[model samples]
Target: MKSKPSGTLSARHIVFFVIAAAAPLGFAVGSIPLAIGRGGIGTAAMFLVAGGFLALFAVGYVAMTRFVPNAGALFSYISAGLGRPLGIGVAFVAALAYALVSAGAVGPFSVFAEQMTQSLFGVTVPWPVWAIGGVVVMGILGQLNVELNMRVLGFFMIAEVTVLGVLGLAVTFQGGATGLSLAALSPSTIAQGQIGVVLLFVFAAFAGFEATALFREEAKHPVRTLRRATFGSIAVIALLQSFVAWSIVQAFGATVVDVANATPTEMFAIAARNYVGDWFANLITILVVCSWFASISAFHNATTRYLHALARDRVLPAVFARRSQRTNAPWVASLTHAIFTLVLIILCIVAGLDPYLDLFVLGSVPVAVSIPAMECLTAIAIISFFLKDRRGLSAWVTYVAPAISALALAVVVYLVLANMEFYTAQTGAINWILPGINLVVLGLGVSRALWMKYRSPRLYEGIGRYGLE
Candidate 1:
C-alpha cells in the first residue's frame, strides 16, 4: 500500500517540528551574532520584523492551504494555483533545496559533535566518523512515526530553551557587563553594516516556515492546525530570538560589534562566560551539538517527505514511496535521504573540504536564497489561483497580502544575489556556482516536466497532485 499520513499530529506537534528545524541555540551561537557584527544593536528588531512579514505571508498562505490542502505544501500549492508543469519545476527546486539543507546540517552536526565530545569527555573522534553516525541515528528516527520524533526533538528543545533562558535572565539580573540597555530594540538604531547580508541572516532564521504546510495531511484539522502552527512558530522564534539577542547585547553592551567581529562564532560562548559562567558556557557548547542534531533530524524529515511525495507521483522511483504502515514512516524515502547524506559527506571528505566552510555553508546558504525565491513564486501562484474566484476570501487575503509577500520575497532573492559573498563566504566562480546549482536544477526540472507534458499526459496530470483529499 502507498504510504499514508497517520492523521494524528496537531498544531503543537508541528510547532516543535518547525522550531527544532530552525535550531534556536545553534542560531544564537551562529547567525545572530553575524547579524550583530554588521547591524549593530538594531539587528535584534529584525527578528520581529521578519516574523511580522511572515505572519502576513501566512494570511494568504493559510487561505491557500484551506483552498488547496496537501502534504507537499509548496508543490501542491503551486500546482493547484499555477499549472502542473511550472509546479513540477518548483517542486524539483524545493526538493533539492531541502535535500541540500539536510546534508548541510549533517556536516556541522558532525563538527560540533566532535568538538563537544572531545571537550566534555576528552575522547577524540574524527568529524567524518561523527557525521556518518549522525546520519545513522537520524535515518532510524526518520523511519518512525512523527510523534516519536517530536518527543526526541522536544527533549533537546527544552534543554536548549532552558539554558537559553538562563543566559537571557542572568544577563538581565546581573545588570550586564555595561548595565542593562534597550538600545538594541530602539527604533533609532538601524542595521548599518552591509544591510543586505545582515537581513539575509535574519530571513534565513525562518527557513522552516514551510514545515507547517508540509505536515498538514497528517495534522488533525489540517487548516486550523496550519494557521495556528504557522503563526505560532514564527511568533515564538521571533520573540525568543529577540530576547536572546537582547541578552547577548546586554552581556557585551557597546562592545557587541567588536566582540562579534573578533570571534564571529564565539558570541554565545563569550556571553555565557561573562554573564553566566564557564560552566554555562561549556553547557552551551554541549547543547549546541544536540541542537544541531535536532536540526539534522528536522531537515531529514523534510527531505524524506519531499522524496516520498515525488516518488509517489513517479517523478522518482516508486520504491521510494513505500512506508511503514505501523510507523507511518516513509521508510524508503528516509533511506534515500540517508544514502544521499552519506554520499555527500564522503564526497566532501574526499575533496578534503572543511565541513563547516566548504560543505555546510556552500550547500545550505543557497537554500536560504532559493527557498525564499520559491516562496515568492508560491505567493504569486496564490494570487493566480484565486484570480478566477476569490472563494469569498477578502481582497487582502487573496491579493493584497500575497502581493506584499511576493514583493518582499522577490527583494530577498535579490539581496541574497547581491551579497552572495557575505552569505556564502566565498568569492569568484564558486560563489555563483553554488547559487547556480539551484537554477540548473530548476531548468532541468522544467525541461523534464515539459517532456512529461508532451510525452506522458497521464503522468503530467498527476504531478504534485499527491492524492490529496
Candidate 2:
C-alpha cells in the first residue's frame, strides 16, 4: 500500500491561517475610512448585503468539512459531488482567481510601499521594487513549513488589529466636529447605491477566510476545527468591522463622506494622530508594510496548497505532489507558486500598472468569482451528496442555505460583469482578458475531460467518484 502522508497539522495551526487571512479585515478597516469619506456612509450597507452572502456561503462550506477535507477546495468538492468535468472546471477557475489575486496586489503594494518609504526614509523608490520585494518575500516564507509561518503571521495580525482598535478609540474620544451619529445604521443607508459599492468592499474584506478551510487535510480533527475557524473568523471579523465602521462614522459624522471623497489618504493619518499622536501614526505606517506582507504570505500558502491538491489529483504534473523530506511540506508546489507570483509581479511592474488601483482590481476579480462559485458548487454538491441518503442534514443547510448562496453569487456575477469597466486594468484588456482567461481555463478542463473520456475512461470514472462515489 502507498505510504500515508506524514506531518499532519493541528487546530493550533489555525492561528497562522487566521493571521494570513487577517489582511482582509485590516484592509477593510483601513480602506473604509477613505471610501466613507468619498462615497458616503451609506456604503456601509454593502457590509450587510455582502455579509449575508458570506453567511450563506459559510453554511455549505463548513458542512463540507465533515465529508470532503482537502486543499483543492472547490475542485475537490465538484469532483466528489458532481463529476470530473465539473471538478476540472472548478480547478481551472480557482487557479485563475488566485493567480489574479497575486497579480492585482502588485499595484497597490507598490503604491503603499512608495508612500511608506517616502514618509520614513524621505527617499523614493520605484513602485515595482516594493511590489516585487513583497512577492519574493511571500514566496520564501511559503517555501517553509506551515507551523513556523503561522507564528509569524500571528504577530502581524495582532499588530494590525491593535492599530485599528487604537484608531477607533481615538476617533471616538476626539469626536469629529460634527460628532458621532447612528444615521449610518438606518435601512435607508443600505437602500442607497452605496450598498452596491460597499458590497464590493465587504467582499474584499472577507477574501481570505476561505483559506482557512483549504487547510482541512493538514489539520487535526479537520471537520470540527475547520468549522470553528471558518465560522469564528467570519463572525469575529464581521462584527469587528461593523464596530469599526460605526466608529468611523462617529468620528466624522456627515463629514465622513466628504473626507472619504477628497483626501482619502489623510483619513488614516488623521485618525492615527488623534488616537495616539504623530509618533503612533508613523508607526502605523510601518505596520502597513507588515500587514501587506502578512497578507501576501497567507495567499502564498493557500495557493501553494491548492496546487498541491491539484497535482495529487493528476490535474497538474505529479511533480507538484512531492513533499519536502525535511519538513513534510509541498515543496515543489510552493516553489511553483512563488515563481508564478514572481513572474506576475514582474509583468505588472514592467507593464506600468498603477499599484493601488491595479492590484486592488486584480485581486478583486478572482475573489468575486472564487468564493461565490465555490459556495454555489458546494451548495449543489450538498444536494447531490445527499441525493442518496438525505436523512442527516438540516433542511436549511442542505437546501435553503445553498439556494440563497447560489442566488447571491448570481447577483454578484451579474454585477461584476455589468461594472467590469469600473475595475478594468490600464491595458484596457480587463473587459476581455479577465473573463476570457476564466473561459479558456474552463475550456481546457472540458478538453482534458474529453481526452480522458477517450483515452482512459477508467481513470476518468475514478475522478468522477472521487470522494462520494
Candidate 3:
C-alpha cells in the first residue's frame, strides 16, 4: 500500500511560524509614524491610539483559536461558523488583501534594493527589476517545505527584535534635546480627527496575525497548540510594537515635528541614524529590505498551503493540490501567486506611483476591509463551537472574546473609512470612487460564490460544509 498521507504541521512548527511572521515589526513602527507626522505632535498620539486599538482587536482574535483551528484562517473560520457565501466573501477579501500587500511591497522592496545596490556597488538598477526579483524569490521560497520557511523566518525575527531593541536603548540613553513627552499621549492630539487614517494604520499593524488560524491543522495539538500560538502571536506582536512606538516618541521627543517631511523613501533610516549611528544605520536599511522580503515570503508560503488544502478538498482547481516531488510543497498555487505578484509589480511601476506611499496604502486598504470581516466571522465560529457543545466554562473564549473583537474591529473599520482622506492624497474622482471600488471588489467575490453554488452545488457545498481546497 502507498505510504500513509502526511499530517499537518507540528506544535513547535506552529509556534515558530507565528514568530517568523513578525518580520513586519520594523516596517510597522517606522513607516506608520511618517504617515501621520504632518500634523506635528499628533504623530506620536496617533501611533499610541492605533497601537491601543490593535491590542483590543487581538483580544477576541486570540480567543477564536480554541474554536476555529485551521490554517485557511479567516476564510476557513468564517465559512465554518457562518455559511458558504459569507465564507467565500471573506476568502476573496483575504486573498486580495495578501496579494495587495505583497504588491505594495514591490515599491518599497525595489526602492530599498536600489538604495542598497547604489550604496554598495555604486550602481542603480531599475525598480522593476528588483520587483521582478522579489516575485521570483517569493515563488521559490513559497515552494519550499513549511518547516524550512519557519526556520528562515526565525532568524529574521530575532534579527528584527535585536536591532529594534538596541536602537531603542540607545535612544533612551542619549536623551534628545526635547526628550520624551507624555503630551504625545494627550487626548487632544489623538482625538484631533482623521479617524480613517488612524484606523487604517492600526489595522495594517495587526495585518498577518490572523494567519495564526491558518496553522491549526498543522499544529501538533490542533486544539490547544493552535489556540495558544494564535493568542500568543497577537500578544507578542502588541508588546513589541508598543515598545517600538514608545521608543520612536522618546527618541524624537513627544512633539517631534516635521516627520512627514522626510523626503526620502527610507524614512526609517532617519530614525536608525539618530538612534544607532551611521554604520548601523546602513545596516538597518539593508535589514529593512530583508524584512520586507521576509514578510512577502512568509505570507506567500502560508497562503499557498491554504490553496493546497482547498484544492485537496476540491474547493479550488485540482491543480492547486499538486505537490512538488522533492519538497512536497504546493507547486501550482505557489507559482500562480508568484505570477500574480509579478503582474502587480509591473502594473504598479507603470502607474508612476510613489513606491513607498502607494504601496503602503494599496497594501493596507484590502486588509482594512478583510480583517474586521474575519473577526466577525470568527466570533460566529466561537459561538458555534460553544453552542454545539453547551459547555458552561467556555463563556469567555467562545462568547465574550469574539464579541469584543468583533465590536472593536467594526469600530476600527468605521474609523478607517471616516479618515480615508488623511491617507491617500488622491483627490477628485479617485478619492470619491476608491472606497466604492473596494466594496465593488468585495461584492464581486460574493457574486462568484453565488455562481459557484449554482453551477456546482456539490463542490460548493463540500467547500461550504467541509472547507476550501
Candidate 4:
C-alpha cells in the first residue's frame, strides 16, 4: 500500500505559513496607502475592527475542527454543517479564490523586482521575464516537501516582519511630524471619509488567516495548533498593521490624509525615506519583492492543497491527487497551479496590461469578492453544524460567535461590492464586470454541486468527510 502524508507541522510552522501568505510588507507598502487615503487617520482602527471580526469567526471555526479535521478547511466545515453539495461548491470557490490571489501577486512581484533591480544595479529587466523567473522558483518550491517550503517561508517572513518592525519603531520613537498621538484611534478620526471603502482593503489584508484550517491534516496537533495559529495570525496581523498605519500618521502629522491622497502609491516608501534614510527606503523596496515572493509561494501551496482535496473526492481529475513518493508533496496539483498562473501571466503580457495597475487590479477582484463570501458561508455552516449536533459544545463557542462573524462578514461583502468602483478606479462597465464574474464563479460551483448530487450521489456524500479515499 502507498504511504499517506504524515502530519509534520507545529503551531509555529502553520503560523509562519499563514503570515507569509498575508505578506505584511507587501500589503503595507502596496495596499495600505490606498487604505489610508480612503479611511484617513482612522485606518488603524479599521484593521482592528477587521481583525476582531476574523477572530470571532475563528472561534467557531476552530471548534468545528474537533468534529471535522479535513484539509479542505472551509469546504469540509461548510459541508459538515450544511450538506455535501454546499461543501463541494465551497471547495470550488476556495480553490479559485486562492488561485486568483496567488496569480495576482505575480504581476506585482515582477514589477517590484524589475524596479528594484533597475534602481539598485542599473539593470532594466522586463516584468514578464522577472515574472516567469519567479514562477519557476515558486513552482520548484511548491512541488517539494511542505516542511522545506515552510523553512524557506520562515526566513522570508521573518525578514519582512523585522524590516517593518524596525521602521515602526523608528517612526514611534522619532515621533513623525506630530510627535505621536492617539488621534488616529479616535472615533471621530475613524469615521472620516468613506469607511466602507477602507474596510475592503483591511479585510483583504486578512485573507490568509483562514489558511490555518486548511493545514489541519498536516498540523502536529490539529485542534490546538489550528486554533492557536488562527487566533495568533489574526492578532499579529491586526496589531502590526494598526501600528504601521498609526506610525505613518505620526510621520505625516495632520497632513497624513492629504499626503496619502496625493501620493497614494508612494506613501509608505516616502515615509521610510523621511524617517529612516534613503538606505532603509531602498531596503523596503527590496523587501517588498521578497514579500510578494513569499506570498506567491504561500498561496501556491494553499491552491494545490485545495485541488488535492477536490481530486481526492473525485470532484476534479484523479491526476490532481497524485503525490510524490519521496516528498509526499501534491506534485501534480502544484504543477497544475504553476502552469495555470503562467498561462494567465502570458495572457496579461499579450494583452499589454500594466503589471502593477491593470493586471493586479483585475486579478484581485475575484479574491476580494470570493474570500469574504466564503467566510460568511463558513460562519453560517458553523452555526448550523453546532445547532444540529451540539456534541456538548458551548453555545457561545458554536452559535453566538459565528453568528456575529457572519453578520460582520456580510457587511464586509456589501462594502466590497459598494466600493467596487473605488477598488478598480473604473467608472463604467468594468466595475460591474469584475463583480459579475465572481457571481458566475459562485454559480458554477453551486451548479457543479447539484450535478454531483444527482449524477454521483455516493461521491457527493464524501465531499467533506475526512480520510476518504
| Best model number under lDDT | 4
lDDT of each: 0.83, 0.69, 0.64, 0.87
TM-score of 3: 0.86
TM-score of 1: 0.96
Q: Rank the candidates by TM-score, best first.
A: 4, 1, 2, 3
**Superposed model 2: Cα runs more than 4 Å off:** 1-12, 22-26, 37-39, 359-366, 425-429, 464-469
List residue ranges in candidate 4 displaced over 4 A.
1-6
For model 2, residues 263-329, the per-residue Cα lDDT tens digits are 7666777766766699987877787777777777777777777777777766678798898888767
Residue 364 displacement (Å), model 1? 1.5
lDDT for predicted candidate 3 compared with the true structure: 0.64
lDDT of 1 by residue, 26-71 (tens): 8788888888887677778778877877887888888877666567
* Candidate 4, lDDT over the whole model: 0.87
Worst 10 residues of 2 by lDDT: 1-10
After superposition, candidate 3 runs with Cα above 4 Å error: 1-22, 25-30, 35-69, 179-189, 192-195, 260-267, 349-354, 357-360, 384-392, 451-456, 464-469
Expressed as tens digits, the lDDT of each residue in 71-149 for candidate 3 is 5667666676676677766666677666666666666777878888898678988777888888887788887887788
Model 4 lowest lDDT segment of ten: 1-10
**Residue 2, model 3, lDDT:** 14
CA shift at 444, candidate 2, in angstroms?
1.4
Cα RMSD for predicted model 4:
2.5
TM-score to native of every candidate shown: 0.96, 0.90, 0.86, 0.96
